[model samples]
Target: MEAVAKLNNYPTSPRKMRLLADMIRGMEVEKALAQLEHNPKHPAVPLRKLVVSAISNWKQKNEGGDESTLIVKTIFVDGARTIKRMRPAPQGRGYRVRKRSNHVTVIVDTK
Candidate 1:
């Protein structure tokens, strides 16, 4: 059995989020949370919360299971809609600015 959680439209680039996700992939839940808690990364904060949420989901699904055995089974980040804006450039020209966002999914299962 497994549990899944998702974070949608997170206001960060998929590339940035994937960096943190890769570090925690296949790691034990408790260790991952501890690593995320102390890591000095912007996206780590939200990713930490997402893991906690997945743990909660696992509890709800399995009434009597050891959480220590849980692991980050699968995780992925996908690019979301980009917010486009115009920036003023020299010589009365305009530059395009894209604010990227991403959707993250985490699936946890017993090791």
Candidate 2:
């Protein structure tokens, strides 16, 4: 059985989140956590939390099951709502500033 967790509207670009997702995809739960813990990327903090949440969810579904064999089965990021703002330009015109956001999903299961 797979356990799932998600982070929604995480206030970062999907590409940025995907980089970390790629780094941890198909990795064991313990190794992923270790990698995320030392990662300097801003998204790593929330990503780490998301993985922990998945572990907790797995624990809930399979009571007393050992998590040592668990791996990150699948993880992905999708673009979310973008916040657009206007920035003043040199020619007295407004430039559209897009603040990208993303939703991340993580699935964990036994190897």
Per-candidate TM-score against the hidden true structure: 0.98, 0.98
Distance from true location, Cα of 9 in model 1, Å: 0.1
TM-score of predicted structure 2: 0.98
lDDT of 2 by residue, 1-111 (tens): 899999999999999999999999999999999999999999999999999999999999999899999999999999999999999999789999999999999999998
Backbone clashes in model 1, listed as residue pairs: none
At residue 77, give the lDDT of candidate 2.
Answer: 97
- Candidate maximizing lDDT: 2
Lowest lDDT 10-residue stretch of candidate 1: 59-68
Q: Residue 59 error for model 2, in Å?
A: 0.2
The Cα RMSD in angstroms, rounded to one decimal, for candidate 2 relative to the true structure is 0.5
